[model samples]
Target: MEIKIDDLTGKEIIELIGEHLQGMSLNSPPESIHALDLDNLKKTEITFWSVWEEGQLAGCGALKELNKKHGELKSMRTSSNHLRKGVARKLLHHIIEEAKQRGYLTISLETGSMEAFMPARKLYESFEFRYCKPFADYQEDPNSVFMEKELSHFYME
Candidate 1:
């Protein structure tokens, strides 16, 4: 699969992101949901990506620069048919590489605390992300699990 820096303009990506938001809604309450919408994904601080294979959207993810040395991961999702195909892993490695190249010191993300998010939590853990307190504008919420990984190790390796 090929990962492209997405402009969030294509119909397929819009539908994919819509599906992601819908899934988040099912797994978490509205107030606890932090997934960004299409418009929010278009903001200057966020860099979005779409993974494709044979011209079909496989998955997508994004990085939101919180500061020169910090960032937040957002909107990671794999197409239903593409689950277990390493789409999320490829997208995640790509985002982490870009973050390292951009000089980010750390990257953080928030996902659901429920069982629906277990796979996601495992994925992050495999990448060495550890639980952390709420960052940025986030506050303490039992429904949310926050995680962070420092990028210096990538550079070290």
Candidate 2:
């Protein structure tokens, strides 16, 4: 799989993001959904990437700079065709490495609290993220679960 910075104007990236939003909306109420739409992903502080395999879009993810020492994971979604094939894992590992390289001491994320999000929680746990109080303007919402991973000594070479 090839992962690279995404130009959101591209059809593939737009479609993939659309699908992600649609899926999230189907699984949760619109009020509880916090996944960034394409416009939000275009912010200056956010860096987004799209993964491709054999010329087909496989998945996408983004890292949003919360501050000099912190980052937030955003827009992580693997295409239905790419599920269980490690696309999300690869994109996640790539973003984690990028965060370390950028000298971020912590990477935090907010994902759905519903059963539909259990797999995502498991994936974050596998990368050593632990549940935490909401960070960076987030509040305690029953529909949201917050997680953070400390990278104080994690160096990427």
Candidate 3:
């Protein structure tokens, strides 16, 4: 799969983001949905990427810079046709690597606490992210599960 920086202007990505938001609405209450819309994803603080396989969009994800030392993962969604095919994993690995390259000391995320989010939670867990209290602009909410990972920077002599 080829992952490229996305400008959020393509029809395929727009449709995928729409599906992501719609899925979030189905699994969580309106007040608990934290997925960003097209405009928000285009913010200067966020870097968005889309994964393509054989010229078809496979998945997408984004990373938002919380500050110089911190980052947040957002809008990680595998396309309906690419579910369980390691798209999310690849996107996640890419995001974490980018975060490290950006000099971020930590990366965090907020996902739903519902059953539909189990796979996502497990994915984060596999990447060594631990549950944590709300971070950044987030507040405590029963419908939200927050997780964070510390990036270990290796210094070369």
Evaluate all candidate structures by whole-model CA lDDT and list the values in order: 0.95, 0.94, 0.98
Which ten-residue region of model 3 has the weakest summed lDDT? Answer: 77-86
The best-first sequence of candidates by lDDT reads: 3, 1, 2
- How do the residues 1-157 of candidate 3 rate in per-residue lDDT, one tens digit apiece? 9999999999999999999999999999999999999999999999999999999899999999999999999999999999988999999999999999999999999999999999999999999999999999999999999999999999899
Q: After superposition, how far is residue 25 of candidate 3 from its true place, in Å?
A: 0.6
C-alpha TM-scores of all predictions: 0.96, 0.96, 0.99
Please give the RMSD of candidate 2 to the true structure: 1.7
Q: What TM-score should be assigned to candidate 2?
A: 0.96
lDDT of 2 by residue, 1-157 (tens): 9999997999988999999999899888887898998889999999999999999999999999999999999999999988999999999999999998899999999999999999999999999999999999898999999999999664459
Q: How far is 14's C-alpha from truth in model 2 (Å)?
A: 0.5
lDDT by residue for model 1 over 1-157, one digit each (tens)? Answer: 9999999999999999999999999999999999999999999999999999888999999999999999999999999989999999989999998998899999999999999999999999999999999999999999999999998844344
Give the Å error, residue 120, model 1: 0.6
List the RMSD of every prediction in angstroms: 1.7, 1.7, 0.5
Report the candidate with higher lDDT, 1 versus 3.
Answer: 3
